[model samples]
Target chain A: MNATQSLRQDVPEQGGRRPGGHGAAAPRPRPGADRDSAYWWEAVGEGRFLVQYCADCRTPRFPAREVCAVCLSLEWEWREGTGTGTVDGWTVTRRTFHPAFEAPYTVLRVALDDGPALYCWGCLVGADPDGLRRGRPVEAVFTDVGPDPADGGPTGGGAFTRVVDWRLRE
Target chain B: MAGTGLSGAAALAGVGATPLSRDSGVSTTALACRAILAALDDAGLGVGDVDGIATHRVGDSSPPWVVGPALGITDPAWHLDQFGGGGVSHAVIGQAALAVAAGVADVVVCYRAINARSEFRMGGQGRAPAGAFDLQYQAPYGLLAPVQHYAVPARAHMQAYGTTHEHLGAIAVRQRAHAAANPRALKRDPITLDDYLASPWISEPFRLLDCCLETDGACALVATSAERARDLRRPPVDIAAAAWAGGHSTYSPPAPGGLGDDLTTSSAARLAPRLYAMAGLGPDDVDVAELYDCFTWTVVVQLEDYGFCRKGEGGPFAASEALGIGGELPVNTHGGFLSEGYVHGINHVAEAVGQLRGDAGPRQVDGAEVALSTGQPGHILAGTSALLLTAGR
Candidate 1:
């Protein structure tokens, strides 16, 4: 067995950040919302994860590029994911770069089972650094990270910027 | 076609550096100009002799356009203003070789000067500009610094190779030992694996000891045609081979399509064979080397990528006594960016030149004839590069 496989656990595990109490700030840097990538963020707010596929060559890519490398086409479309993925790699951040995050959180790179593997970054709800292994099955769990909508105006839990997290599947 | 006539076409005639410190207390421009003058003087040339200039900038250092006139060279025949950081190090040197080989100009000077500690600390947690599409994907996830970006691949290497923290600590301890011999090294005291493990974790699997120093300094070198160099003062360190190869992009893990099956493989994987072929030599032929050490894992990765060991063997290879002065491959003889100062990777070039010239004093590799210097890899836009230098007539 490979080194990663040797560390694998057969039991299902929980991963992804739990919602903080009412007044917690977003614990990460905000993505740049420009013309090319606004649609991806919009999908995240609606509790969906999206990846870009080239309209001409039918090639899928992440973070949205201007032109398709294969067919040189400038056209593309956003496709919803299948929500199933495998943990291809991960890192447990013991130190927080942002104030919103507490110490010791896990970031996993999940290759979505959507046709070609579309790699997305997110927290694994309850996984520890030692417990993670490659090839672990996971499914998406979008979490509300924006300001609260109950306050009505630009207060807590805004609807525009929810984050896509993940949980280990049995 | 590897190396072809490019071998022995240009020579590094001189190398210079400002005293490394946490704060230089001077402007980056002044530091850059001072190092350039020192290099030119070491080459037994004046500002007028510098007909070509190549340097990299990140809105911090003085560009060649600005540095040239300040050095009294009003107009240079060749100039290159490379972008990004250590990943572009040897590629900038390769630019100087290209200029000299093509006869665009002679007496090309390559330099990198930054007030990295005082003005722009590399270790800070500020977000990078959303210039590349990959940053758009990574920034929102709190992957803020080079340490954070590299952690993804470092962890993959660990999982694939069984590389432990002790292995990473070995690299730190060995480089620190080399640094202790060199006076210019910033952090010279020895560190045990226990001390390394105890150092605070900047990122997962990466402790404070794993990261390189944030230094305020400048390093510069003069390159000219081999014929011209023979007439100069110091022994010419012939630019035997300089090759810049295409590598993976900045697209996050489960890399973009062209990166192939290995997330743990570095650009040096493809770059080293090409580099050695161009130099008409192999890994075993190198007498000394200066691999870029932006992080300790980088040293481990490059050790494998440069053909020093097998892919999964980097950690164990580093943990052995093989990387020290009397060992198989004496790496980072001037301590490396981890312990030496961070002048991007130009200090690697400077150290290589010093080794080739038999001027490294106590830390010099014995019979160090053929030297290798490599740049950081995996910059989607900048690519990566390596250089082979040899003692010349």
Candidate 2:
């Protein structure tokens, strides 16, 4: 069997953001929307992670597509989400893309339970031995993992601060 | 032609390229169509008879029907898009060959185009230790960027084989020399091993010269059967063997939790034997090689992994340009991806075709009969591909 097939059940997984809540601290210059992604970005600013719903099929879609990649239905709507999913794949970055961020953080592609696959590039864990398994429940959280002036954006203070973009929710 | 030992049926008949500039000034779709049409014209084939298209995985889209309609052809037999990402252009040609060989199609065209220069904004990004892959794994501990990734392996190899950085410089010098002769190469500056060593380091041991110049361009080739090629204006280069495979996927389940595939064994290891067997030859029997060299060390790794030499012998073997003209093997006579244009690995196959067809202008390998070309993506596990070509049927 291939490596993934051999992975046991009950292994913990996390993605989208971090494991805990950031309470409430919205930062400046929120990642502006581009290419039909305003709704998803706006909801994130409202402290609620959400995905677009194909109004035709009522299925969640990610990366904020104007059309449902699955059904190709143009009718669309927004849906609040718990942001839970299992880890599909991940990479550990030893350096940040910018100076304000730390290196060696995890980037994850998480499969959401609400029915859309999401790719998130941000810090995911503290230095832990627990492996990020293929299919474990995780919820979103924000964290202060960078030196950016946003006292509350994910990874802001360069500390292992956990904000709830995602967490291993039991 | 079953035991067709020593018959040279394939010759790269034509080679075409789009310009390499910061902003390519055209849509990727437009660039691909132009490159394909230009290659067909170069090979003396008209658009009406064209019926096949193959493209790179990371390349811009080229819908067969859309491209066929634009090129003014109808009902092209087969259209395929391969995604080994970078460095699989030459390997894709093998698929085109199968189409014609099996009578699925009579003519095949392969092409690649990328706006990395514009889309990724890669330039002026200092060649510092990027620790890109290791940023979360080892870069925070100081392992960084392409050079640093390569450096780790270089250091491990140094300890194992006593190889030095100077040995690696020899490869850079020879490739640039080939580039100096090709007017299309982005880097035409004359360089020597001394110039190689003197250039400042981007990361430990790798200097400015040890890297490939990323460009914005597209290249294409037209392949037809040897039987029909005789009637065409340009001779068709026969495809003896073509194959490719991936090394390790960084995001797969095998990486983070389990011990991944060994980095020492390359992507080529999976496909090389079948390719050689199909061509009825081995590495030693081949006349020339156009191994991919996105980085200087990639050439070394491929040389050993592809059975040119024993593992760890690559560094010393490279020092003499053993693959250049008058050397045991003449590799990358077109300067390869290192000094040549990096249309992924498409240019390598074009050069091989040129050498076998005796079309290479100055840097040609004298009377090359059997030419082997290959590409590998990652350092250890590669997305490896190979091609074997001869002059005629």
How do the residues B1-393 of candidate 2 rate in per-residue lDDT, one tens digit apiece?
242322233334556778765567776667778888788888887777678887865424555556666777666788877765454666677677767767787877787766545553232133222222213223222223444445444544554566677877888888888888887787778787788888865544466777777667778888777777777776566667666565443322222222122334456666677777777778887788888776788787778877888888888888775767767898888887678767677878778878887777888777788888876545422355778876675
Tell me the tens digit of each residue's lDDT in model 1 across A62-160: 656677766778999888877889988777666766654545556777777874546777766634457778889998776655443232332222334
lDDT of 1 by residue, B164-222 (tens): 99999998988999999999999999988889989998777899899899899998999
Best by lDDT: 1
Kindly report the interface RMSD of candidate 1, rounded to 1 decimal: 4.1
lDDT of 2 by residue, A93-170 (tens): 333333322333344445667753343323243323146554656666543222224445342222322223344556
| TM-score between model 1 and native | 0.89
Cα miss at A160, model 2 (Å)?
Answer: 9.7
